[model samples]
Target chain A: MKLYGKFFLINLQSQMQYKVSFFLTIAGQFLASISTFLSLLFIFSRFPEIKGFTLNQVLLCFAVVQMAFSFAECFARGFDRFPSMISNGEFDRVMVRPRSAIFQIMAYKMEFARLGRFFQSLCMLIYAMIACGVFWSLSKLAVLFLMIICGSIIITGLFLVYAGLTFFTVEGLEFMNILTDGGREFGRYPFSVYGKEVLKFLTYVVPLALYQYYPLMYLLGKSDKILYGFLPPIGTLFILPCFAFWRFGLHRYKSTGS
Target chain B: MIEVSNLTKSFRVSTREAGFKNAVRALIKRKYEYIQALSGISFRIADGEMVGYIGPNGAGKSTTIKIMCGILTPDSGECEICGRIPWKERTRHVRDIGVVFGQRSQLWWDVPVIDSFELLRDIYKVEHSAYRKTLDELTQLLNLNRLLKTPTRNLSLGQRMRCEIAASLIHSPKVLFLDEPTIGLDAVSKIAVREFIKERNRNSGTTVILTTHDMQDIEALTERILLIGRGRILLDGNMRELKQRFSRHKKIAVAYAGSLSSDMLSNCDGITVREEKMGRALIVLDSNLLTVSEVIEMLSKTVDIKDISVEGVTAEEMVVELYKAYRI
Candidate 1:
């Protein structure tokens, strides 16, 4: 944790060296997400509800997925950039370090600019918390927190899978964007709105709905079962196989030229 | 100590012809050619020995270093460093070694050099006092005081390289691997880097394995040379002995007051007149067969010898000769 702090501060200092570019990137990230937010608003303006859920209820789902995604993007950017790191031989530097390769790569890069998206999602989450008609309770609040936390873990696990694949082929696999970026885009509405088949696919294959949909059902009072509220923690288990794949790929790593 | 025995690694490289049609075909069905990077190579280095690992391009010099540094796992072989198998105990093995790849930069480009050093210090888990002591020593030895405050992107290549060496040493690792450390430095920077490396090895007893195409680096820093070619150890011997072996023929440039006939020296058993002009001649002679005095006496007999100088074969020429001899 202390080493992570030092890495964080150093990365901040490095980014701050180009003040204008730093601010511009943050602003660019903010405006880009705002367009997505506006698109959601345009859909709601055309229809008051998506699949019998109010705009505020759908907003809650969007905010949770957005916040979790941006959070993962902020911290796990290194894995997202793993292909370039391998191609440019930075992964060799990571291997020589005394720390764990995962830890070193996490510290290698941090996308603080993604905080713009994070802040926007925080605002939407707060608005949904007040207007989405959920009763105020400690357990309900805990489920909301779990949704974001485990949602980020699931997304970060996907990023790990993406990074691990780079060890086999030293290029970013474009199809992986379907699970990572596509999950967030498709997640703007609750998984149930996508129909039974898509919901089953997301639940069984990727488990994006384990955090975003089932626990969300408990949060919105659609289900009173405690198990639904706790499903997100089970979703965190997705990281295990993803991490195993990463380790397997690491063993097969063939470093680029010196 | 480092021990490598029967190490072998091969890579499967996908090949395609350079055309849109071939590229599309490769996308559908690719053909791969296997390259044997290291083929049953082995060597051992005891504690505190600075050895030069030299080879022609793509002869597995970097492959050996990468394995030693715990970066790549050999397909089949045994490699143990500091009593631990590098790939098996990677994290633990890496704690005792430092590697510098000259073509890459490890320092954070946008941060001051000291920040990178501090981050490295933290990464290595060095005590504050120990880190301070090592940093002070490195700053003084590499003259990094002025450059420490500058961002790595802003510093000159030489200055950045100096800081790079210092950063790697901040933890005082037991072994240091330098792969082409002086690839594109000016003369002064090269000398400075070489001097610092020698001083560090002498003072700390750190084992140094250096890989470079620059024979000057080999000549200046290392006593033992491990020459690899075609993914095999071609020669392993003392630097001086190899130089002496290649230095049997001595070059002598002669300046005289009058013209000399090239046939005069060409007719001799051990001398070959390389060049002859109106008043000067260049001669190559086998030093074992004829002494310098004998050649000078013979030259003096034919022409008024004004001045003469004897030169041995340089390390560069010796390496080229070795490469040619090995047919690499």
Candidate 2:
């Protein structure tokens, strides 16, 4: 943990070297997410209810998914940039170190620019809480916290899987974005809005609905079963297989030219 | 201690002609050819031995270093360092070793060299006191005090290289692998690097495996050399032995007032007159068979000698001969 803190500080220092570029990138990221938020607003203004869920409820869902995505984008930037690491032989340096490769790669890069999207999502989340009529209770707060943590884990797992695939293919598989970026886009609305087929796919295959739609339903009083509120922790189990895939990929890792 | 036997590694790389249509065709049906990077290579280095690994490009020098560094696993081999197989027990084995790939920068590019060093200290879990002690020693020995505050990208190649060496040694590893460490450096920087390496090896008894294209690095730093060509060990011997074996011939240039007679070269067995013009003659002689005095004596007896100088074969020529002998 101390090592991680030192890495964080070093990365912060490195990023601070280019003050203008750093602020510009953060502003760019903020505007990028803001555009997505505006698109959401336009859709909500046209039709306030998305499959029986009001605009405010959908905004709450969008805020949660956006927050999770931005957090993963910040902390898990290494996996997102895995292909360039492999191509440039940075991965070899990771292998020679005594530390775990994943830890080193994660520490080597920290996307502070993603904080722009994070704050944007935080604002939307607050506005949603005010606009939506759900009462603020301790249990509801706990479930909401669990939803964000579990959601970050799921997205991070997807990034890991994406990184693992680089070991096999020469180029990064761009179609994987349909699951990652597409997940965030589709997640702006509750899974039910996409119909039952999409909800089942997200639950059993990707497990996005387990932490997002199911517990969200319980929090919104659509369901009274507390079991629904506890499903996010179970959804974190997806990380195991993603890690297993990474280990397998490590074996087949053919390093690039020296 | 490091031991490697029968190590072999092959890579299957896709091959295609360069053209618009060919690239398009490759997308549909790519073909790959297997390249044998290391073929049954074998060697052993005892603790504290500095072995210079020399080879032509694509002759498996970097591949062997990569395998030994635990960055790449071989297809079939037995390699053990400090009683641990490098690839199988990577974390445990790598803790005792440091590797510097010359073409790559291990330090964080945008941060100060000291920041990178501190992060490395934490990653390697060095005690604070030990880290401080080692950093002080390195800073003194490598003259890194001035370069510490500079970002790696801003430092010159020589300066960055010094910090690179320091970064690797911050953990006080038992073994160090340097691939082309002196490449693209000026003479002063090269000498500094070589001196630092020799000092480290002498002081700590740390084993060093160096791969470089600079023959001077081999001649100046390492006593023993391992020559590889075409993925196989071609020669393994000490510097003196290799020198005598491949560089016994010396070139002798004699300037005389008059041209030499043809009979002057007839009786000379080991000496070949390479050039004779304008009262000067250049002769090649095998010094092992015929001494320089003998050649000069043989020449002076026939032609009046004004000035004579003999040149022994250089380390650079010996390397050429070695490469020629191996046909790589």
Candidate 3:
């Protein structure tokens, strides 16, 4: 953790070297996210609810998924771009260090530009909270906070899975994005809206719905079952298999170049 | 101490022809061939020894280094460094070693050299006092006081290489693996790097394994040479033995005031007139067959010698001769 802090500081200092480019990227990220926000507005304007859920409820889902994604993108950007690290032989550098490869890679890069989407999501979250006025309670608030935190972990697991695939073939694997970026796109509304099959797949296979849909349902009072509120913690378990896959890939690692 | 025995590694490379039609066909039906990169190569280096690893391009120098460093695993063999198998105990084993690739920069390009060094300190978990002391020593020795504040991208190749050596040493590893550390360095910088490496080895007894195409590097630093070619260890011995085996000939250049007939020295055994000009004669003599002084005495009687110089064969020619002898 201390080394990660030092790496964070040095990477932040590196980004500061290009002040103009840094701000431009942040602005670009903000604008790119705004288009996604505008599409949500256009769809919500067409119908007051998506699958019987109000616009405010859907906005809340969108805000949580976006916040969690941006958080993962900001901190775990190294895994998201692991193929480049492999191709450029940076992973060999990580291997020579006396630390675990996963820690070194995790601390390798930090995309501060994702702060643009983070702030945008925070604003949407505030708007959704006010518009969807649920009675305040400590457990309700705890569940929402845990939902965001666990959602980031699940999303980070997806990034790790993506990075793990690079050891076999050091090329960008596009299909894995269906679970990462696609999760954020589909998580804008309740998973149930996607029908029974997509919900079951996300639940049993990827487990994106454990944190996003089931827990959010209990928080919104749509489900009286208290078990649903605690299910998000199980989503953190998804990282275990992802990490195991990473270790397996690491054993089969064939470094590029000489 | 490092011990490698019967280490072998092969890579499966996809093959295809160059034209567009062939490329399309390759996409449909790919053909692959396994290229044996290293085959049954083995050597052992005792602690605190500076050994030079020399080879032609793609002679498995880097492959051997990578396998020992735990970057690439070998197909079949054993490499134990400091009582640890590199690939099995990667984290523990790597803590005692440092590697520098001449074509690669371990320093973060956009960050100051000091930042990278500090990060390495934390990564290696060096205590504050130890880190400070090691940094101070390396900074002074490498003359990196000014370069540390500069971004790695802005430094010259020589300056960057100096810092690279420093970066790899921030942890003060027990064994240092330098792969062509002097490549592309200027004369002064090369001398500076070689001197620092010698000093570090002398002071701390850090084992140094260096690989390079530069014969001067081998001559100046390492007493032992390990030559690999076509993925096999061709020669393993100290400089003197290698010299004695391959460098059996000596060159004597004589500049005479008067014209000397080529037939005059031709009668001498084991002497060939390699070159002859208006007032100079270059003779190649096998030292085993005939002594330099004996040939000089024979030449002196034939001509009025202005100047005579005898030189032993250099390491450069010895390597070329070795390569030719092995037909690799």
The chain B TM-scores of all candidates, as shown, are 0.97, 0.93, 0.97
Roughly what TM-score does model 2 have, to 2 decimal places? Answer: 0.95
Candidate 2, RMSD to the unseen true structure: 2.0
Better of 1 and 3 by DockQ: 1
The positional error of residue B174 in candidate 2, measured at the CA in angstroms, is 0.7
Taking the tens digit of each residue's C-alpha lDDT, what string does model 2 give over A128-178?
988889997999989998999999999889988999999999574888998
Estimate, for each residue in B1-328, the C-alpha lDDT of model 1 and write its tens digit: 9999999999889999999999999988999999999999999999999999999999999888998888999999999899999988998999899888898998999998888888898999999999989988888999988999898999998998998888888888999999889989999999999999999899999999999999999999999999999889999999999989999989999899876877878888899988888787889999889998899998888789898999999889999999999999
Number of residue pairs clashing in candidate 2, backbone atoms closer than 3 angstroms, sequence gap of 3 or more or interchain: 0
* Tens-digit lDDT string for candidate 1 (A178-256): 9999999999999999899999999998999999999988899888888998999999999999999999999999998
lDDT of 2: 0.90
DockQ of each: 0.83, 0.78, 0.71
Q: Where is the poorest 10-residue window by lDDT in model 2 chain B?
A: B258-267
Q: Would you estimate the TM-scores of all the predictions?
A: 0.97, 0.95, 0.95
Question: What lDDT tens digits, residue by residue, belong to model 3 across residues B1-328?
Answer: 8999999999877899899999999878989999899999899999999999998998888889999998888999999999999999999999999999888999998988888898888888888899999999998999999998899999999999999999999888999999899999999999999999999999999999999999999999999999899999998889988888766798899999776778867776788998999899899998878988888787777788999898877999999998999888
* Per-residue alpha-carbon lDDT of candidate 2 for residues B1-328, written as tens digits (9 for 90 to 100): 8999999999989999999999999999999999999999999999999999998889998889988999888999899999999989999998899888888999999988998998898888899999999999999999999999988999999998888999999999999999889888899999999999999999999999999988999999999999999999999999889888876799999899765885557566787888888998888888767898887777788779999888877888999999998899
Clashing pairs in 3: none
Clashing pairs in 1: none
